[model samples]
Target chain A: MTTMPETVVPDTGPADVPPVPSGGVRWALVDGWTLTRRAVAHWVRDPAPVVFSLVFGVLIVLMFGYLFGGAMRVPDGGEYREFLMPGMFTMTMLFGVGHTAQAVTADLDRGVIDRFRAMPMSSAAVLIGRAVADLLLSAVSLAVMVGVGLLVGWAATGSAGEFAAAIGLILLLRFALSWVGVYLGLVLTGPSAVFGAQTLEFPVAFLSSALVATGTMPAWLGVIADWNPLSSTATATRDLFGNPGVGGEAWVTQNAVLMAVVWPVALLLVFFPLSVHAFRGLRG
Target chain B: MGASGDAVVVAGLRKRYGGKNGGGLDGVDLVVPHGTVCGLLGPNGAGKTTTVRILATLLRFDSGRALVAGFDVAERPDQVRARIGLVGQNPAVDEVLSGRRNLVLFGRLHHLGAAAARARAGDLLDRFGLSDAADKPVKHYSGGMRRRLDLAASMILSPAVLFLDEPTVGLDPRGRAEVWQAVRELVGRGTTVLLTTQHLDEADQLATRIALLDTGKVVAEGAPGELKARLGGDRVEFVVRDRSRVADAARAVARLGTAEPTADPDDRRVGVPVAAGATALVEAVRLLDAAGVAVDDLALRRPTLDEVFLHLTGRPADRVEVRK
Candidate 1:
């Protein structure tokens, strides 16, 4: 007892060490799905934020639809409420990028991401699950904005199929924006950085035909607005919804539907892989 | 334990941050016998967390072989992660979720079905004394409860080896004891633990073997009592009332130890660093009496691990105060 008094126990330890199979593609897919479910589970526990994001978009829509709709002149005697629906939907999707960024950074700072890293799950599951969950949340937020638009007499006069396509465009924009969120979250690792990243959303959305017609702006500014991806989606969504939108002679407005699909797809092609690559280098 | 039962083994482990001479491990080696707790004792920045990180497969070491549960950490990280659980220096469980959900989330990640994950979550909640707070958000729990939940989250699968880096750091005494109790329960169930701590008392209380690390290297490795014995049993110290008599007492006690006794002028004390139990205690009084150095008070104090660290490294283990 005088020397080395601590009791040392002997054990038969677990030998359930999984083999490092060169490829576990199916396992990775299953694991990625499970992690996506986990990300969805967060919504169940904290639905307020989910609800608040929806309501925040609704509040913005209401503000623009009524508070400013009467004073603001709609192009060609078109209802301002009708002109604002597509822009609000695009703005709602853009705002979701900030939410995703903040959530990702919070997980990183709190070691939640570290927990997943230490596990034997697929590496891509972390970002993929988060992106999927954020996409779903953005869809809900867009739906809330649409409900607000309908209440204010903003009619989608197009066919049911056109409405579905418009929704698909909004969600596609959300998916691309979420990749930007994931990249910024892994790289910045600070709440303030999320706010800084979100600051870009306003300039990008406002410079376009989102809130107003690009024709109302100067020629140079209007040209830049027409070139914006948000403008493409907003103009395309308005055309598809049969809402009042700028009928420009320019190629971008004329081909709004194609550019709407092309822009978000291009963004996904660039940022989705970029964010995945960024996640791989996060340890550095 | 048999050689095959060593749950964790590191050989020639080296890592550097930035370029060179940045805070990281440098050619460190360690071994933990199965089912026994190995306390990696060191001050802050002593590479404890770094070593644990490498073993847990969350880090890439510059050059080394780290084996966990008999799987090479680098070549077979998936194999290693499948068997090992890491309770990091910070709690990693989600605060927004209830303790129960947190456990189930980990269980599901480990590939347990929903029914099995729910059952395991229940069992862990009971084992960790978190059943009462299982349904409450973790943000509502106390620090101790959160740590217990963190431990529970890691043990969802009864991992073969668990790495807890400074688990009790920043915990209150009650909280620390609760965590220690939980750790003890895990160890009793045949889980090997690699615990990094700065508290000497904590190592004494929980570790089967203690590896004292300094500047990313194991300075000493042994049982607590064995390390204490290295300083030669007990410390014999006395203070003289008269300042003038301090020098005479120091010279008298200098002959007692293998090395010269150290004198503290501020306390008017001279202490013999090494003494073989009570026999030297008796001899020290006789010698001081013979040297005409009257002592105000004299006693033989058992040397603590802190003293052993000071004796071995010529520096006190900074931040080594009994934290809990």
Candidate 2:
């Protein structure tokens, strides 16, 4: 290539940047909060998806509580609606993975993720903010579901402490699964992947003990269901909620609370790093 | 922050992919002095976007040294990112968020306080002529408006260097012109711009210097006029009525210009660079008439970027394979 004579450099001074420490934990928190606000603002501007997801959750409850409740029985012969409530809460949390993935995929498709990656803000803040925002939405959805549950003749018979603990377990499951969503959003390709994820989540949600007793499943399937992370949370939340679908003979089911705590933590340990790696490796 | 006067310095950059997909850069070297636009002009898959992506600290290059805003792209991407801004092919702003909201969000991410961010957002909206639509969601804004918002988002920190990768690829003619006007304004404010485009006119209109890329390499680098000049003055092109007479026409026209004439049998056209524009046209016409070769079209035209691409890369610009 032919070279040209060097042109004169202009006399423009440095960019007008204020002196703000842009490193370490404080900036990370600031950046994370900023991105969280961005995600929340999107929810505010386009409330359809959020509204649809919440309505869909409620529809599931109504469909099962009234329409399907007569045909099903809890293993310990408790009210089917009571047994179903804790399961529904756990399912609501689990479905958050789909929401998280959809949001992430939308950002990626729109090249918003690329812009965020190119910025000087905290690298982890993108995923952190997304996870936190999704958690907030999940918390809202859980509260609405709890209200619907109570209206449908279900009660949290446990003490206030156990009730809080059940909520914590539910949110923890959501917090953990959100990383899976982040990783999937980063790695999956095409528009179909987002919708495809929604379809795939059905089996993951249904095969667990969220709506029925794992003991009712085939013996081989019951073992698998009993060990499912969703099942652990469902059983553990039922135990905490003092709802009566917690009966299972498998060691994993008997140790639901420990497994409930262990599953999400394990998922976090596995997926947090994976999500970070995926975020850092993003390229087109 | 650079010790040298250049805002961007790329040395022998190389990035290779696993397969034969031709998006890999061989060894690209570039220098863009401060406060000037350096256009990376090429056809699709010419590695233009790859270079910009690396310099913007968004991609990790396999090998090479790149310094943007005085920070090494590989070793200190954060520093480079802090000083540089990027407008990718897509608008990248949230479709659901209002234009003002998008800008303020970017401002806060840039570490501006709430009041300062709002003030800056207002200023940018005014500067970009987006104030009327500032409170409207970006999805409702026109293509030009969305691009303007994208530009405003990138300018939140008044970055020293801006990397625009095919910034006007999908816009209509009017939208393209709007973005070009916006870019000119930014350039006047002393932001060094590295713009990549497949549009020759876009490069011609905006870049003070253009680096012609082909097959992931800098095939030619100079000002637009200089690149055109490198093709050797004006050319008189003519089409023959009879395809068989194209050779005869070239044989006649060859004597009119000092250099040999090139003929296309398919188009029955012959073109040759000449020392004198109008005189060469008249002489060529007379010679072709004398040779009994009927002419279809004749004109003296400056070398186009398409010709420049052909002259430098031995192929038309658009024929290059798409890069991954």
Q: Model 2 over residues B1-324: C-alpha lDDT tens digits?
A: 335889999999998776764767999999999999999999887899889999988877888789987779998887887888899997789898899999988888888778888988888887777878889888898887788889878888889899999888888988887888888888988899999998889999999999999878999999998899888979999888998888888888887776989898987778888988888888878898889999876999889888898999998887857545
lDDT of each: 0.82, 0.86
How far off is residue B61 in model 2, in Å?
Answer: 1.3
After best superposition, candidate 1 residue A157: deviation in angstroms? 0.8
* TM-score to true structure, per model: 0.89, 0.90
Per-structure clash totals for the candidates:
0, 0
DockQ for model 2? 0.35
Model 1 ranges off by over 4 Å: A1-29, A36-41, A71-77, B1-3, B19-22, B239-255, B285-298, B319-324
Q: What's model 2's interface RMSD, roughly to a tenth of an angstrom?
A: 8.5
Q: Is the docking of candidate 1 incorrect, acceptable, medium or high quality?
A: acceptable
DockQ of each: 0.36, 0.35
lDDT of 1 at A111: 80
